[model samples]
Target: MESTTWEESVTDSINTIYLLFSAYLVFVMQLGFAMLCAGSVRAKNAMNIMLSNVVDAVVGSISYYLFGFAFAFGVGDNSNPFIGSRFFALADVPNSTYDYTFFLYQWAFAIAVAGITSGSIAERTQFSAYLIFSFFLTGFVYPVVAHWVWSSAGWLSPSSSDLLFGSGAIDFAGSGVVHLVGGIAGLWGSLIEGPRVGRFDAFGKPVPMRGHNATLVVLGTFLLWFGWFGFNPGSFDKILVSYPDAADQGNWTGVGRTAVTTTLAGSAAGIVTLFGRRLLVGHWDALDVCNGVLGGFVAITSGCSVVEPWAAIVCGFVAAWVLIGLNILALKLNFDDPLEATQLHGGCGAWGLIFTGLFAKEEFVIQAYDSGETGVTRPYGLFMGGGWGLVGAQVTEVLVIVGWVSVTMGPLFYALHKLGILRIPVEDEIAGLDVSSHGGYAYVAHRDEGHPRYYADYMRLQDQS
Candidate 1:
């Protein structure tokens, strides 16, 4: 093998470090999701919710390492647009350090997809079934969709000759690949698992099942917001390798612009949601605000590197409105999503993709185009005098992703249902999964007299008696 040049070695080291740092930030999202899910359920099921989050990281890591990574991104020339053909069980890579860093980053993304599905079935689903679903989801379902968009050979990606419109689909940070796939899977899971107990009333109106802790929810939301900095900016992957030289300041453009747009979009959505909530219900809800912030993040993710800042604000504001309407509509249609993952991710993710097609600037798109690395030109957006081709491509992606996830996950969940493992026993659910499934309460401060924790403490006190 040829010896590496000093510049190449330095650039590789920098890339690895930056990717790992970004992965760390993304990994922190697991904590945010855990706390968020825990806060969204009743106190009785809090442990179960937190445990599921833990499971996402553990199972997701192993599964992705085994097959998920390979399926999503193959090693060497085995990778194709439709699917990856090698790297099973994480066979050794040629570039161990850099490859491993990339794997770690992608691993975090796989875990996130599983974690997103967990909240929709919270408080009612069986742990065993969720474990199974997570394995397959990361191993296959998610990878297939990811391959279609992120892989160099993907038909819908800029690299493929099968481009549908303009420069093909543009998902700067997985508005469709990550958030949409997760949201659609959650939608199907909710439908198959059915609503949580007492989710609907005798009059057929949706009944609210309020989350136990608002403080935790807000805290989790803040963490997620913080993580978005790494998420949106890190997608460039080019910024990290650029040295701060006179001519190299341009490298910072994508990272800086993405960060700014991400912040503005999230902030704009939060503000819009606050007012929208008041006008609709005469009261503002903390949960709604949190979801609004997340919705905005999802909405701007696809366009953050390509759109102007003002367009980001418009995306966020509209995302809030869409979320509000989508939530109400889901309730009316009997779809139960405790964390509103469906509306926030599904609705906002689609909007992000479409919004990019409308508002993406010509120069920014060109900057991010990476000189046909994906095999397509950086087509301008409609509002930039580019016409409707990009918009059409985005819409096509949205429809294809929705259909793909639904078809794959819907049946899998239904089969799990047939096996009698899809959900816990109704009695177990009513009494709470913590006591019945996990054998403990999440909060002991308010435990009933003779609760298990107290019982355990009492028994320990009399040990050897």
Candidate 2:
């Protein structure tokens, strides 16, 4: 008995350390989001967007701690399918089923949702409005969705006693719960705010308001790619459990396979986008390639653990076209999103869910959802002959996510717009939010030295001109 207890203790310790490392890796994605936003916007608005990204993490931390986590996973004997009902403010936390490391990992996911929305309304949004919506999103709107899909008590959870269509939604790493929710919320916000000032011409023609730096976009993309290893494989939440039938194999194998699928999906999408854009626009664009890579990642996130690596490649390949097609539609509709947050996360994210329903392997599903212990077989991929139940569940998830986010975030943005605080003033936007609102540029060419030399040189140059 004592030896058994010691073994369990070691396993628990190892699992805790694994979760903590993954949480730290996810936290690094915040930096990636900041850099990506900074490079995607014009130089004049770089400071504004980067500042919003910083505030997203800070505000998300407090709100998720106080309310979001409770709403997402808190449970009791009276647990309902719609929401969590206990553990507010981290009370009674570190319980048998969850620990502080779990909270940290979840908090990282909460902030990522907010980060996605920030990219949609990047340059022309009010900072005060950003704060209000960020808190609401992290604290209330997003948590409800998380509860529906992730919580054990959730109706859509595979672990639920009563699963949706006897399978529930296989959002293994939150293609719908995180990416779709964030992307749909962003869609509403962008629609209400309309396009950025110069994004469309007078006759409704599209204008290419290119970002100032391609180097930063590339850098941010790579950082996000590195962070995704943690985002997908880490969702397993544990690595010590052994499969029932497999000898000397366990969740560790699934974790490694998840990582491989993530890599192949993103790589395939990037390559496809590179060539696709060349054919479409007659140019090799690095920015488009980067966005395509992210779109593929978003799409495969739902099935990274359950789908084969080859299926992941197909997911990414289709995801590239989905993103490209959405971009074209956005342009035609005169809808401007600086980072393509809605299309990449929202559109490709939806595709990812469907892909899971179509390609998820039965054995992998049993391993991931049932821990390979339950003898009961569950519905799986339609194309794999597992049947329509899982695909139906996947479709249900997509519809509900779209409906839920639209219902919640749509009205909030509309209310802010009615109050005249949703968007920045025209003059502030025209002069750039940095100068008009933030007090300085992100990069300064000349600084006042408390001397006449700089002023005299400036005056001479002005006179010459």
lDDT of 1 by residue, 1-465 (tens): 999999888877877787888888888888899878888887878989899899888998888888887777774677777776555846633258877887788888888999888888888989998899899898888887777877776777855667657487888888899899899999988989889877887777986678879989998999998888878887776554343233454546578889999999999999999999999989978888999999999999988988889999999999999999999999899889988988889899999999999998877776675531333355778888888888888888899999988889999999999999998887677667887888777888524322344555533432422
Per-prediction tally of clashes: 3, 0
| Per-model TM-score on C-alpha atoms | 0.91, 0.94
Candidate 2 per-residue lDDT, tens place, 265-345, comes to 999999999999999999999999999999999999999999999999999999999999999999999998999999999
Output candidate 1 Cα RMSD. Answer: 5.7
Cα misplacement distance, residue 67 of candidate 2 (Å):
0.6
Clashing pairs in 1: 81-153, 158-374, 159-374
Model 2, stretches more than 4 Å misplaced? 1-4, 95-98, 446-465
Each model's Cα RMSD:
5.7, 4.3
What does candidate 1 score on TM? Answer: 0.91
Query: Model 2 residue 338 lDDT?
Result: 93
Q: What are the runs in model 1 whose C-alpha is more than 4 Å off?
A: 75-78, 86-89, 92-94, 240-250, 371-377, 445-465
